[model samples]
Target: MNVSTASARVPEGWREVNRAMWDERVPVHVAGSFYDLDGFRTRRDDLRDFEKAEVGDVTGKSLLHLQCHIGTDTLSWIHHGAARVVGLDFSAPAVEAARALAADLGHGPERAAFVTGDVYDAAETVPEPSYDIVYTGLGALCWLPDIRRWAETAASLVKPGGFLYLAEFHPFTEALDDATGTRIVRDYFSRGAQVWDEPGTYADQDAVTVNNRSVEWQHTLGDVVSALAAAGLRIEFLHEHDVSLFPRFDNFEVRDGYHRFPEDHPRIPLIYSLKAAKS
Candidate 1:
């Protein structure tokens, strides 16, 4: 289901399509090997090394995770000593899964909360913002159509002197095809929605079969940085990496548990981390 244009608002008609697709993916992801719930039961920290390094320690802090699918990373923050944590997702099933995972992990509502709502409504829906850390990780921003509104909401959610941390697939990487990682299959700048209709979710491609359709927007590095700056957030640092946390392409190699390009492939930035503070 293709939308009229890429420049639509956050609660546009196409968002329903994306939401339905994500709702269907929740069950598949929960039972899939990609998440490895068994492994997570023992090895609690699911955050990537870059995320840890970029966001730093969350000990004794209040954290809010936006678009937190299933809450693995949100729970990881709790294990890392966050005093309070809240995870928000548009999909009710994902939120339910997250709450169940928290309970199974022995975390109670006093320590963790999961809310089901559109991220665009987070500023108003989430129990009073002003969290110590507002964290957003990879494979998130593409789902949203409005970066400026997202930046403003993230800034509003952060407490004074606190920061908004983002770790995401770089726009440059998004422009390349996942099969070869060399073909320019997507626009790098803001354009109309990139519509897709595939058979499965990214977590487990063959685990289930459904006509999974979604709409994504392409955003440049400039679009991201400028949005935050416009929202009255001070840019701390923007770091680009050649390695990604996932094997986005067929030729990617696993290094130290992370998926990176093979040595022979041309070096290109695959991911980016940005930290901005509310003044």
Candidate 2:
């Protein structure tokens, strides 16, 4: 699929827009309860069960976390015994907060390093065939306009036999109307046309501004798998979960740090985690 359109450009203006939005949200998100800095320090693995189970054994391994907003999850890997970690994102404010948090928690510069750049740009900027693990968390994939470039960049970052791990919201869940306060409203198999013009963010409910025009492209589960496979990453495992990390549906309930529709509700996968090895 062609990702370059009138809307999806990597020009100076588009990057500036993304930077401003992220800068505005960084402070709000850091103070918000969703990130929970205290919980991150005390219960490092609490937010990363999917990664912990699928990515397995990172002791003495070098890990690169892409689109690592605020670096909470990246630091979590360090606590889980990763030897070295580098967190990269496009937002200056987010990376600053990540660095501050790492220093405050005593992870220090020796264990973790934060870099600010576009994911594709950082892939080239960071040392190739150096990282033992490449990782990204939820709410990451939708921001990008292309999946093929993302997969290619991911493949280039990891060493031969190293792995890439991603745990993100299922594409099917994106079809549903998050603001309708009702049922699903969007298409599940839409290949063309982009979702545009969205105000406010999923993280904070109170901070709504005019800078809400983000272009998002949707890809099916098959599309993701095929892209990674074509990039020479062998699929290790793909796991679908019934529970989501956030309240996806309006009627869902948050229980035990997970959101779930009622037992009688329609069965739809809310989240999916994948592990692929570069062999």
Candidate 3:
């Protein structure tokens, strides 16, 4: 929010464009009810039930979170019993907010740290060369232009025997129409950049904002698995779920703790998670 904007994307590229947008949204997200900062302060941060179960225990293990937007989830790892955690993001504002929130939670730099760096440069940017666990999730891969490069970078950060865990929105949704989510509207396997010229942040669709244009890429579930495999990480498991934490379509209804299509509607892979380990 404190960050200024209005730079043209043509001169800077997708990273700059995306960074500017997120930098601008830091204030909005911090204050908005979407993040529920107040509630997080009162409760111990836990990942989604499935995520927590899949990731197993974090007790005393050093963990690194890639694309850790504002460190809310980063700090949660500590609360979940990780001995130490480091959160990395390209947006300085997001890292700043994360650090501020970490301090408020009584987590000093020694226990919880946040760094400003591009995801591609994470292997060299973070203080530690590798970690016991490298975690990436919650809509991270779409921001990347090269899934192979991203996988290589993420794989390089995981210590031998440690694993990289990712839980992401299924890329299949990108192919479906937004309204009913049943019609095909875009190429499911296209590698071209998808430019979205829209206003407001996802947290507040109606919010007045300046950095509106964003460019994102789509990587199919196959693309992700293959990339990690090429990066020297052995495939552990790939699991798909029919529910999402956020409402992704008009017909999606909230059930239990996640959003799902109606009972009569055929289930689709709304979200997917995987664990690939360094042997």
Candidate 4:
């Protein structure tokens, strides 16, 4: 789907801005050493250990992956035996890349589908209460402005007994400034607006451009759980981990596909995964 026009509906011009950013970041991410496409193709569990442990046994289940950038993890679910997988993202370029990858792997529309659309508009475009699992991965929640709307959409997509799974960066970690390698710059509990000047992306370090203005919102851990619960989903499990899927902090060490802060680093949670089921 061509999402160029849909980008106009995004509040605060974020749709267009994020589209451009993801478009530019696609090739960089595909070529980046961090992704390791070849390795991923050979191994099904290329994702974080927490993901493997939390999102267990998806065999023959229908899954909807929201904010599925380039559809890497979404495809991984297919490899793990998901009967059908639908990947939704706002970036046309990322969706194109994902389609190409799926084709390369011999997966057709019968087994997997990719759509380019805003998360808020996804339910309008696709069937709701049709999926057994609604999944979103790390770094996805920050891009969205409202958790309440997200939870509503998530609940709508899941079947009566279906579950929603999310593995995201912890709100506490978002308060720290890892760029300067110095000190805590933002308030941990502050539910304030954050304006970012960004020519590049978190995955790419070499990218530099003129359009470098975007806004993001921070939600505390309490905010995330409460929003989902209020949306009529029952919390099944909530797990916090000290390690992350990527190097979130400058002083972190990468060991065995996980990133951890220094030995004496504060015990603040770095990543968290949650599972909620619709009653």
The lDDT of model 4 is 0.79
Give the alpha carbon lDDT tens digit for every residue of 1-279 in model 1. 223334444435778888889888889988888888778878998998878888888899999999999999999998888999999999999999999999999999889999988898998777755799999988999888889999988899999989999999888976788787988976676456767777676787665656476788877899999999999999999998888877888888898788888888888988899999987
Q: What is model 4's C-alpha RMSD? A: 5.0
Q: Which scores greater on lDDT, model 1 or model 2? A: 1
Query: How much lDDT does candidate 3 score?
Result: 0.87
Task: Give the top-scoring candidate (TM-score).
Answer: 3
Best by lDDT: 3
What range of 10 consecutive residues in model 2 has the weakest lDDT sum? 1-10
lDDT per residue (tens digit) for residues 24-108 in model 4:
7788777776676767666744566668778889899999999988888989999889999999998888888888878878899
Global lDDT for candidate 1? 0.86
Q: Order the numbered candidates by TM-score, best leading.
A: 3, 1, 4, 2
Q: Is candidate 1 or candidate 3 better by TM-score?
A: 3
TM-score of each: 0.93, 0.89, 0.94, 0.89
Candidate 2 clashes between residue pairs 3 or more apart in a chain or in different chains: none
RMSD to the hidden true structure, all candidates: 2.5, 3.9, 4.0, 5.0
Q: After superposition, how far is residue 41 of candidate 3 from its true place, in Å?
A: 0.5
Clashes per candidate, residues 3 or more apart or on different chains: 2, 0, 0, 0
Candidate 1 stretches greater than 4 Å from native = 1-12, 177-179, 183-186
Error of 3 at 255 (Å): 1.7
> Rank order by lDDT, top first?
3, 1, 2, 4
For candidate 4, list the clashing residue pairs, or say none. Answer: none
Pairs of residues clashing in candidate 1: 6-192, 6-193
